[model samples]
Target: MKNNATLCFPAFLIGTLATLFGGEIVSAAIYSITNTTLTVRYDDATQTFSVTETATGQTFLIGGKLEGEAVKATVTGRTIIVTQADGSTASLELRENVPFVFVHKTLRNAGTTTTYIQRVVPLTFTLDLRQPAAEPRTMGTAGLTAPDRRPQHRPDHQQANQAVCSSAG
Candidate 1:
């Protein structure tokens, strides 16, 4: 039985999103991190998250919510970290200047004895792909631009990168 497990989303894709859509910052139970072309938000009360296109205000996630109840929420720079009652934590970080956000989740077993984690679902969200209008594109280091998904678009890859943690035997 492992004590900890970690899962992370692709940094490059979200980083690209941040670089393309830019905006200001706001505060409240629902926190927002905006890049040049997109906005990422986390609702502490509901333990939910969402990504929106700044131009059209169209959100990419529908009925999005984390799997657990959030006990605490912390913000540092452009990152938001939410801690759950089970000692698990989820972090969403938005890079500066660049366009994308980095999402990471850590599942922890706080009990003294070995606990078998049936499954730790970090988030549950239905992706809203109503107005898919983005094309696959890339940018150089010097400058960058997102796809022409004015009304909206979707990420090229459906899955995110996973980081496995060694068990404390």
Candidate 2:
């Protein structure tokens, strides 16, 4: 529901990659969309993103590298459709009151001949755990020495698990 998110990083390395589509990579403008708990910013030129925790003002970036170019991005309702230069598409959907954003990506063959994609890394998170607000929390438990030490954002494990599982499906 918040709309004041900005794009600035203090702990990341930004680098550009050569174009993969055999055409000039256009530097598109940056844009953002928010869910209930996080604000996500995307650089269309690099096809990279940064996530900011809405409550804590903590920001995490795609560490040290960039991806392919995004030719277009369309925001429809709570979903963002991004079209890459290689004919692939990635859709980012944000649900109301949900902290997690679901991503669905489709890879396509841009060229006339058949090609193979060896590896695809959506993004790499470089977390700054040194910050006091970035300290990890052991949810649904009082002590860290518990038998099952699961790092969860929500206080209830059942709800957290359900939220993650359902959203991922």
Candidate 3:
């Protein structure tokens, strides 16, 4: 019984350690661009990635097994590299506070040369957190409605007449 217990303890410890830190750590974020919402995820260990468009429900896999070939992903500091099975590669460098979309395309007439460009764009993000809801407020007593606050538009002739009158005065 003592020998069996000792054998099981090492296995249990190894299993526990693997469970604690074994696979790649994945981080994901949802970014909004114009009318599209994209969810992108990066695997820290493998450096492979995928992006899903929420509107179309389409997913694109990059340098992963899902591409029907084994690919290797590596990260050195802020730079990530993904080497495809065909010896092709893609890379991305992390930038501070800058939102960008990686556009990958094959160069026309370039014979298998592919290019990856980072296009910086504005993004909006929302976080889900528990917070106290605010009570709705009633309209103020100032009698200012939505239309009253809007700028009034004048005709071109009226503006011209006002300008002439002001200049004359």
Q: Give the per-residue lDDT of model 3 (tens digit) for 1-169.
A: 0110000000000000111335764332211221134444445343334444446655543332122122554444433444545444444333333333342211112223323322212112232223332422223344444434534545754544331101111
- The candidate that wins on lDDT is 1
Report the Cα lDDT for residue 74, model 1.
74
* lDDT of each candidate versus the true structure: 0.62, 0.53, 0.31
**RMSD for each of the candidates:** 11.1, 12.1, 24.1
TM-score of 1: 0.59
Residue lDDT tens for model 1, 32-136? 766666777776555667877777988776556666777877766677788888788888777766656577888776656555453446666776667554633
List TM-score per model, in order: 0.59, 0.52, 0.26
Which stretches of model 3 miss by more than 4 angstroms?
1-40, 43-70, 101-169
| Model 3 poorest 10 in a row by lDDT | 6-15
Which residue pairs collide, candidate 3?
A: none
List ranges where model 2 is wrong by over 4 Å: 1-28, 62-67, 111-116, 131-169
Task: Give the lDDT ranking, best first.
Answer: 1, 2, 3
